[model samples]
Target: MKDILEIRIHGRGGQGAKTASQFIVEAALDQGKYIKAFPEYGPERRGAPVAAFARISDKPIHTYAPITNPDIVLVIDNTLIGFVDVTKGLTNKGILIVNTCEESSKMKEKTKFKGNVYTVDATNISIKLLGKNLPNISMLGALVKIANNISLESLKNKIKEKFLKKIGEEKTEKTIESLIKGYDEVR
Candidate 1:
C-alpha cells in the first residue's frame, strides 16, 4: 500500500455501489487509515448509472472531489464497459476488477483498457447465495484481493458489523459467503 490510494466503483443504482465504497472506507478506517467514501449519481432511481469514489491514505486526504485518476477501478456492472468510459483517468498501472463471467482479456479488449484486469462472477455468486442481483458484497472481496491494501478479515468484520443489524445474521452470513467465493474465484 502506498501513502494514498484512490478507487472508483461503477455500478447501477440499487446495486450497492455506495455500500461497497462505504465498506472499503470502514475497513481502511478500522486499520487506522484516513479514508473518504462517497457516491455520484444522477436522478436517483433504480438501475441508473452510479459511480462511487473512495480514497485511502496513511496521511490525511486533502481533496474531497471525485477521483480523477484512480489506482484501482471496480466495475460491478460489466455492461457499463461500453456505455461509460469506465477506464477513463485510470492509472496505467491501475488494476481493473470487474464482475463478469467472461474472461478478463475479453473484457479488456472490449473496453480497450490497457491495464491489469481481474474478473469474477459476482452476480452469479450473489444470486446463488443471496437470491438477489446485488454484486457489491461479492465485488468487495474481489477488490480486497486486487487492491491488497485492506485485509479480508477486517472487511468481513466490518460487513458483519454494518449488515448484521439490518439484514440479520443468516442473510449476512450468506453475503459473507458470496464475498468469500468472489475472493477465491476472481482471477
Candidate 2:
C-alpha cells in the first residue's frame, strides 16, 4: 500500500455494507496488513441508510471513528445517494465506486464528483450469479480490482477461507468464481 487508505461504505440497512467493510478488513489482514473495520450505528431498521468504514495501512492505525474525508467511498445502494452526501468529506484524489447500472459518465454528471467515479451493476450481477440480491461480494471484487493493493487471487483465497466454513466449500467456490467473473466484467 502506498499510504494508509481510508474507505467509507454507504448502503441501505440489509444491503451488506457493514459485512463488506468487515470482509475487506479480513482480506487485508490476510495479506499481513493492519486494518480497522467498524460500522456507525443508525436507526435499527431495514431499508434505513447505514454507513461502515475500513482503514488499511502498512503502519499502525490510530483512528477508530467513522471515516470522513475518505480516500475511497463505496456506495452500495444508489437510493442512499439521495439521503446521504456520499462524496462529502471525500479527499480530492478519492475514488468512488457506485453499485449502479448507470454508465460512469452519467453518474459523474449526476453526482458532479470531481474524482474517479466508477460504476458496476453489482446488484444485477449478484442476482444473476448467486440467485440472491447479494451485491457485497461483487462490489468487493470491483474494489479489489480498482484499489490494486493485493492481487485478486490473494483476496479470493481469503474470501474462501472466510466463507467456506459458513457457506460450505461448494458454495464458497461458486461465489469466488462469480466474483472473478464479475471483476472481469467490470474491469
Candidate 3:
C-alpha cells in the first residue's frame, strides 16, 4: 500500500457506503493512522446515489472531497456502473471491488478498468446473512481482505463499538457475522 491510502466507496443512499467509510476511518484510527472519512452527495435521501471517501496516512489529513483518483474503489451497487462512472477516478494501480459476479475480463472490457478488478456477491451475502439488502458490512469485509491494512479483528471491534447501540445486539451480531462471511467468501 502507499504511504497515503485513498479509498472511494460507491453505493445507493441506504446501502451503508458512508457507514463503511466511517467504520474504516475508526479502524484505521485504532491502527494509529491519521484518517479522514466523509460523504459527498447532492441529496441525502435513501436510494439516491451516494459516495464516501477515506484517506489514511501516517501524517495529518487536510482535505475532504470526492476522491478523484483513489487507490481503491468499492462499488456497493453493481447497477450504478451503468449510470455512474465509478471507475473513472481509479489510479493506474488501483483495484476495484464490485458487488457483482461479473468476471474480471468482462468488467475490464465493459468498464475499461485499467487496473485489477475484483467482484463479490455482496448483496446476496448481505441479504442471506443480515436478512436485508445492505452491502456496507459485506463490502467492508471484502475491502479489509483485499487491502490487508487493517485486521479483521480490528474491524470487528469497530463494528461492535460503532453499531452495537445503533442497531442493537442481535443486528450488530448479524452484521459482524456478515462481514466475516464476506471476508471468507472474497478469498
**Best-fitting candidate, measured by lDDT?**
1
Order candidates by TM-score, high to low. Answer: 1, 2, 3
Off by over 4 Å in 2: none
TM-score for each model: 0.96, 0.92, 0.92
Task: Show where candidate 1 strays beyond 4 Å.
Answer: none
Clashes of each: 0, 1, 0
lDDT string for model 3 (41-119, tens) is: 5779998888999998888877665577899999998888878999877876999988876776777777788888887
Error of 1 at 23 (Å): 0.7
Q: Lowest summed-lDDT stretch of 10 residues in model 3?
A: 60-69
**Deviation in Å, model 2, residue 27 alpha carbon:** 0.9
- Where does candidate 2 have its weakest 10-residue lDDT segment? 178-187
Q: What lDDT tens digits, residue by residue, belong to model 1 across residues 1-187?
A: 4678999999998999999999999999999999999889678888888999999998999987768989999999998889889999976698899999999999889988888999999999999999989899999999998888899999999989988999999999998898899889999
Error of 2 at 40 (Å): 0.7
Task: Report the lDDT tens digits of candidate 2 across residue range 1-187.
Answer: 3468888999888988998899888888888899999898868678888898999998888866667778889898887775589999976688999988889887788778888898889888878867888888888888888888856877788788888899998878778876786577663
By TM-score, how accurate is candidate 2? 0.92
- Which stretch of 10 consecutive residues in model 1 shows the poorest summed lDDT? 1-10
Q: If both were scored by lDDT, which would come out higher, candidate 1 or candidate 3?
A: 1
Model 2 residue 138 CA deviation in Å: 0.5
The C-alpha stretches of model 3 lying farther than 4 A from their native spots are 64-66
